[model samples]
Target: MTAAIWTDGVPVQGLGLMRLTDDGWGDSDRDPATLVQVALDEGVTLLDTAEMYGNEDIVGRALGSHRDQITLCSKFGVYRGDSGRHDDWYVRADPATVRTAVDGSLGRLGVDHLDLYYLHHRSEETPIEETVEAMAELKQAGKIRALGLSNVTLEDIRRAHAVHPIAAVQEQWSLTQRGVEDYLPTLAELGIALVAHSPMGHGVLNQNADGELAHELSRIASELGVGAGQVALAWVHQCARQTQGTVIPLPGTSSVSHLRANVAASRIELGDVDIRRLTAAV
Candidate 1:
């Protein structure tokens, strides 16, 4: 899938709804319903959610009359483990589970189909090809428009892509976190887009925190006459441009002001020297 094919007119910045349901991140005063509308109004058409987020119903109600106006995305397979810790989540992508999960997601989201449906995590007990084959069946059944993979290895991508064309890969990538950079060449070669989740270091890069990258972002942001968060987004965009792949920074925010600011950040451009400086600082 080429950048144009995967993006398909979706903006370079998207809205992540994980934070909407997480009390640790979102504002207690902000309503998730209104945040969805604000995202559409800002042209952030890529609205991402997940079964794990536990807010599909809220997102569904919020989308309301404008569901057709955005590329609605969701994920499956990830389930709570015994410990129930964030890092202890488990995955199950058997053919039976895949069918049951999609139906449940559709019911919760109040939609007949999903624009993009991702296998949230690789299953240790199941083969990637089998999981993707099940997803392809869903696409054939008109349940999902495109297939995506998240938090998957490069080998997983190759094996899954062989079964079905992968439209995108969702992972964490930002100025402060660049592990996903290693996958850029392969993703570009495959023509699969990279949907960068937590592209702002999960809000650390935006705060006035004390750190080398923070200071550097502030310095470059001051020179560019924009906020540091915008600089971070610009770097992600420039990095994607260099790789010749579609990399949409999916940042989440319950605050309307923060959402608007992030949308505005999508347009900030950075020079080569500043890009290098920010790249090196990280």
Candidate 2:
């Protein structure tokens, strides 16, 4: 639907898109367009899409008139076929690949310049240094505004940041997944923002990590006066209050109402007890 999460570090806000694995929109009652509009009206400024999602067309269609008002992040690395082999993922980012990926993303997104581009690289085949250098050059050349990385280690981040100024780092950081915590302090020291994908724990955390985003929403519908996604988003906000608020959680849905509820979570304030329960439950 949209990533209503924003990092206080940069002025740009965010809207993280899902690969949309299924056909039905959330709640089985909404279409893509209505949900996109609601997010735009509510101050979500960054739209995240990936080459793997096969939803660039849908994302492009939903962007409509608000394209200029948002910051868009599209990722590329592992090349996929229609058959969905989806493997042999590139652990390294190459200049040629990054260039070609940006060109393709620009074509699919129908835009000239990308707001932020990440090296969807995730392996050891190619030297990450070579790839990050290319990313730096791309930013200097006006192909992208900012450079980011995903699924990387602390050492990888250190090496990459030494070569270029990274605007953000996208990772799987949620109440259930605290691995990033071990390294997030280093990121904070480096001034890099955390784009927490699956911040709702893929619909598991708010649903108590039950593996269904919809069911999770139902479980927390009454307590916080919002959906489960809202509760989870609120938890992230609290997590960052003690940190840098650099924790930008991405909770997406095809439902307009749920998307709004997700945004409303930005204003939610979970009590210290609730925060303790949510944090430890993970």
Clashes in each model (backbone N, CA, C under 3 Å)? 0, 7
Query: In model 2, what is the error at residue 110, expressed in angstroms?
Result: 0.2
RMSD (Cα, Å) of candidate 1? Answer: 2.7
Model 2, residue 268: distance off in Å is 1.3
- How do all models score by TM-score? 0.91, 0.84
Those runs of model 2 whose alpha carbons end farther than 4 Å from true positions after fitting are 1-13, 20-29, 81-92, 206-221
Top model by lDDT, which number? 1
lDDT of 1 by residue, 127-220 (tens): 9999999999999999999999998999999999999999999999988788888998898889788999987888878875457778889998
lDDT of each: 0.84, 0.71
lDDT of 1 at 15: 89
True-structure RMSD for candidate 2: 4.6
TM-score between candidate 2 and the true structure? 0.84
